[model samples]
Target: MNNYNTIVIGGGPAGLACAVKLHKNNVSCLIIEREQYLGGILKQCIHDGFGLQRFKEKLSGPEYAERFVNEVFELNIPFIVNAFVVSIEKKDGYTINVSTVEGIKTYTCENLVLATGCRERTSKQVEIHGSRPKGVYTAGAVQHLVNVDGVIPCKKCVILGSGDIGLIMARRLTLEGVKVEAVYEIMPNPSGLKRNIYQCLVDYDIPLYLSHTVKRTIGYPNLEAVEVMEVDEKLKPIEGTEKIIECDCLIVSVGLIPENELAGRIGVLSDARAKGARCDLDFETNVEHVYTCGNATHVNDLVDYVSESGEVVADAIRDRNDSERKLIDIEVKGRCAYLVPEMIDVNKKNNKRVMYFRSNKILKNATVTMKVDDKEILRRVYANLRPPEMERIVVDYPELSENSKVVFEIEEAK
Candidate 1:
């Protein structure tokens, strides 16, 4: 059996960042990754637009991941690659069962950080009626084939969903001399960032059809074409709007869900709306001595935020001690989709706590208000709020007395 101060599951950008911070602080940490290499999903994300916020320069996914990987090496943080953590349960601290080639091994840690990241939603999840075809692939799979494996999966393709991955893949296919027929999005607003919409679709002159969706894919052994349909405000397909677009490949990039299998095994309560573990201000889950960060906490729009979250968790882990938390549940109003760190540890000494959230519907000139026990504490005005773009806000808990309650509401600017 091996032991450490903290054992981080999954060696992606988040896990690596956490380990690096802990190592710098002279904390013993181990990172367990199932993949053969570090970097996680960034390995296949060959397109640029990353590291703009973190590095203040445009970098591809691999480049940005390399920065963290290099730091991990410099710090001499130990990591086990190609080792999958199969089970985890409480044992004094926590016992992690890892499945390795040599054999299953056991490791114990005082605290655990889950940075399992996220997984792409497949065609089945989106409920596209079609037979299994060879040409159908997720945006990530296509990206790996094209960038990592050096093989273009398609010469002509129809992309479903306007998320960043799908949009980037559209541009990538276009640059590879492949004909990108169009990108279909069921929602009225594009799911990707505004800049991505412009640079990837509009800048490249690739057609993007809003309020549209893929009805079905027709093919025997491979994809021959995709039937497109317009969706109503409810996102239900409208009859008589079916348009068959002939394409060899159909890449689906609907959405990403936080991978919380490990958390679930340890009885960590997950927030259905956020699709992640319910965490406090310190990013610790309801489960004792267990914490979650990065995409496992929530699906972040930027990978840099993922790294930042890792550092936050690592710092929190450094000061962790068994103590009763003064927890306060956060409530939302006025089209608020969801909020990360669903609760605040009022007992925590940290005055300023970073919180992230999104609005359910498009809001223009809105004001976000935070009230403690029915009294206004924090209020910020925004020009606009969209579900696709997440907003990070800091709330100060300076004047909290006994029986304090925190609630958030978004009101359109008058």
Candidate 2:
């Protein structure tokens, strides 16, 4: 088709859920996915623990994704698989040029949803001085190799980041008859969830070395070992704490960066904190009809939140107002790492304003407060707050003018 009411440029869980919701709203939407399949990264995630929030069941990643994929299929939503979006232009509405099996095809849409997801941090990005070798791979790449291709990449591996993927891979490699020596993290705190650390490392009897980092990779054509070092609180390496661990493979799962290159092409303002598009409560970017959701918005820890973001964007597009978007910044003060929907559109009287935020550091008995013009409107006390676990909040914020100051503050209890 040459046109659609909305075009979602990803066939992952976010795009799939977005299309399903859009279809339910009687909106004609089309999905374009670069991968041959619709499941995105979930395809390689074979372990369970997904869908706890959304489905209320412990389902595997594929299972969670399959639910939405089936809905899209049953709803008869239009989708093009293995289609890469070559370029996007905002001529009349939005023009999307996609490269498909048939040929280059052009499609137009009134609204565009970017669900391109996130990319893993590589060895080079983390400044791991190493020679290019076959054994070094990202956690996601190792996942695909083992799960999809049924090929075990290595016999002995040392994971260089206690990220969720690295922790999970530590256990996964063990199950696949590979020896996982240890997981090293540069930060004092684990980068992943507490459950992941317990289930993947603690339960698996794998040790996690905190405040430690891989200093150098001692590998040649294939692989060999890595030199590790301990770091101080400021993350500066301690001189004499260096040690070398022998392992055939090095799995790098330091972190993920949101895929916002497409958003950048359309003059969308970027948020350095969120590492994505600067969006309002409705998930709409500065550019009128362009929207961003899922990991394209930020690296969400759970798949459920990714799907939730998609639904939010779908509903926003359905109930869009013609009134000018009077956007006001939701200033973050103290302890908050970042907050999604950093701005709120006062003109849109959407009672249910959903937001996601994370703590800058671990805090016990933390108090989170929302205020407008120094008038505290909402305040909630959390018994414990951790940086890895993201907190979601829904507020029916009071009506405000364009100049009203909206701020969210977090403070540790005395």
Clashes of each: 0, 0
* TM-score of each model, paired residue for residue: 0.97, 0.98
Span of ten consecutive residues with least summed lDDT in model 1: 397-406
- Candidate 1 lDDT by residue in tens digits, 162-248: 998999989988999999999999999899888889989999999999999999999979999999999999999999999999999
lDDT of every model, 2 decimals: 0.89, 0.91
RMSD of 2: 1.0
Candidate 2 ranges beyond 4 A from true positions: none
Q: Candidate 2 residues 1-414, lDDT tens each?
A: 689999999988888889999999999999999999998889999999999998899999899999999898888999999899989999899999999989999999999999999999899888788787779999999999999999998999999998899888899999989999999999989999999999999998999999999998997898899999999988988999989899999999989998888889989988889898889988999889999999999889899999999999999999986888878888999899999988888898857688899999899999999898999987999999998999999877888888899899889888
**Candidate with the greatest TM-score versus the true structure:** 2
Error of 1 at 378 (Å): 1.2
Clashing pairs in 1: none
